[model samples]
Target: MKSPETFEHLVRAEFTPKSTFLNTATNALLPARTVTALQDAVRLRAEGRPLDPLYDDVEASRAAYARLAGVPVERVALGATVTLYTALIAASLRPGAEVLTVENDFASVVNPFHVRGDLKVRAVPLERLAESVGPDTDLVAVSAVQSADGRIADLPALREAAREHGARTYVDLSQAIGWLPVDADGFDYSVAIVYKWLLGPHGGAFLAVPEDFGDLVPVQAAWAAAEKPWDSAYGPVAELAHSARRFDTSPALFTYAGLRASLELVEEIGVDAVHAHDVALADRFRAGLAPLGHEPVPSPGSAIVSVPGLGRLQPELSRAGFALSDRAGHLRASFHLYNTPADVDRLLEALPG
Candidate 1:
């Protein structure tokens, strides 16, 4: 485990954002090492060198992500987006199956099931989600941390509720993974895009499923999903992978090359350490908000703080070099390992009274 001082020092050395970047809930700034890896990948392609290393990077990321998510690599599938993975789950659902979701959650988690047209989709407030699960609910899908206001879902309660109702759970970890310690194995299915809190490049996502691959059909399967990819290249997959790899979407090679390095940094610092660091800064920001006459959205134990009615200040804050997001008229500020108390205080100082 890295000591707090060492972790802070590592973060300071690795990230050099020109702005006080506090929008990690929206996207993360790549660390210097990841940037170097991406540059090397591009150079390799430009120089017509062997692309073998890039493929190695993809496998390396799969292993690293599996470790981070606390699941066997066989249960993890590499993908380009959360929506594709969610769609695969949606496809597996029988007609008239019901999906319970959090109201106003990220669209990627909710839209796919609704688009199916035949499935019964229901949305409820986050606090009421666990209790809302019923015998008719086939799946309970929600983000671990809500994107708009950073409210954390009650995963344990949801898990218990789903189990009691004979329902499966699907969690989107895009806004939670790096800073939040999640056991992906707890869910029947989970998906995350690593670009946000995982600090990887866009186009890299992961899906974790049961060891038996659940009921998914891998409707988007390609050569890469075959048991023997190279041998099956010219024809339809001779045999789909027995594991969750059958659900994989062809990886974006360059994205994985950078992601390998980013995941390495995350491992070194550790998620628990990052969580402590992030939530402390967010609390500091939250405490300061009231003095500035701004009351933030109630989100205890979260690294993202959203102040309702402060959306108008976002453009001015951006111009002042404080990076954040304005979502549905709420100014959302997210903290991560790279953020410090000074960053929080400076943003507080910049807020209008």
Candidate 2:
């Protein structure tokens, strides 16, 4: 086991705003190394290359992310996962199609479907998710880790059920990636933001679509997604890139650079190792909060530890130089690679009844 001081020093070095604890609602702090790398990419851009191609860092990033997810680089789509899904949901569902999801999910996943007046949306009771899976369901979107309650649904099981009903399954891995293990084979589409659990930049994400699902297309295709990014300023273009790059076009170079750095750092550390370390800190934080008469809501397998009354104690924790967040009436404690057991202890010691 790493020493407490070593852990603190490591975390402090990466997250420069050392005093602030990013135990927030759903978001976690990006790794410090990622920020520095993003700075380097900015410098490189300012230095200027005579001519550079779009997604210059793409191949390297895809290879790295693919290795992590145990999928092929060609199978991955890099963009804001939420945007990718939003576009996909709008494109995939026709009028009057019903979308099924759990009530205890992140608003991002459910809101998009509900907005379509023609598409009816229904909530599957958490206790009866299996029963809810049936024919006539147009799509089933679910969070790998519940954004509100932090519960992890059985994605594999859900996928299996959705398959039986001929419904396309979409999974939000935003809170699960980097904190838990995910099998790419289980879902037809997997969406995630690299910023949160992946400890990367916010501007980029991944949309993993299985090869067979060629019918799935984005509503808006950008320049980068075109077969010839150099040709035509505007038109309804179908000559999209051969891979998931079809949906994600154009380049957010800086964000991509930051994401590359973050992914590289995680790769060096190993995803499984990251999960173990975070779970340990979360466990410590949960145990520490137990005596305060606060109970942590169970999450699937991520580093999020939410206490029902944490927000109520925010003032007290703040007075002690610590901060916490209250989302939907629960206090959420999130851990990242930079966090250590001692930090959990400090937050624990600082909590008030």
Candidate 3:
């Protein structure tokens, strides 16, 4: 077993080491390496280092995510948010076609389709989403891990279901990508925001586009999406990139500074190892909750272990310094690499039996 220090040791001591924090579903604590990298980048900029040099950080981050997903670098696009990528996917759908998804998923997934009016979006319950997909369904959208209940979707089954009906699949990996070793074979596109499980700054996300993209336009094109951004202008609209690079959100330069380091850090630790750690902690959390008469919703397989109808207890836990999320009647505890057994003990001690 890798020593706990391999991952946890580098977390900043600035975070109250005495307190228990498990709100990764809401956001994650920045590792000390990422914090230091952000600080150093700011100092370098103040010392007259050209912002142009920092631009490469975007490419570096893309490469890092590409490596993590075992895809070619060209298949990865750097962006500011998962919402933007979902919107971009919506741009490619046929007008008035059906896009099926769960209602409780983050709005970014389904709202884009609703606002466009080009697609008929059905916001239904998770259990109904897969069953609802049919030949008329242009796309089936879901998070690999449900946001509120921590329900891990059976991707293979969902993919098979979607394929049988001639529909495209899109997965938002905001909750499960880093902590679960997800493969792209099932979905045509997968988007993830780095600030959550990725442990990066807010303005960073990635879109894994289809490798066999054909007749797929750059949904919402920016100048950076041009085939040759530096050499071209608004004169004649340059060709959109053939690869996923065309989806780049034209983010701010500083956004990539901290993200590059964080993505690389996740790569170093490896996704499988992270998944094991998260699952083990979540199982431990569930065991503790058993005696408390609390149960995780949707059977916990992901890092997020939420107890239904426990929302009322959130205030008491918060008062004890246990950071968590209480939403829609579920009290959520999201674990990550930095968490330990002691942290879980702290929480169990605080909870009323």
Best by TM-score: 1
**Per-residue lDDT of model 1, residues 86-149, tens digit only:** 8999999999999999999999999999999999999999999999999999999999999999
Regions more than 4 Å wrong, model 2:
1-17, 20-26, 47-54, 232-238
Of 2 and 3, the candidate ahead on TM-score is 3
User: Residue 284 in model 3: shift from native, Å?
Assistant: 0.7
Q: TM-score of predicted model 2?
A: 0.88
Worst 10 residues of 1 by lDDT: 229-238
TM-score of each: 0.99, 0.88, 0.92
Predictions: Cα RMSD each = 0.8, 3.0, 2.3
Candidate 1 residues lying further than 4 Å off, grouped into runs, are none
Where does candidate 2 have its weakest 10-residue lDDT segment? 49-58
Q: In lDDT terms, how accurate is model 2? A: 0.72
Candidate 2 lDDT, tens digit per residue, 2-84?
Answer: 45555456556666545547463355576777777777777777878532432566566766777766677777877655855
Q: Write the candidate numbers in order of decreasing TM-score.
A: 1, 3, 2
Best by lDDT: 1
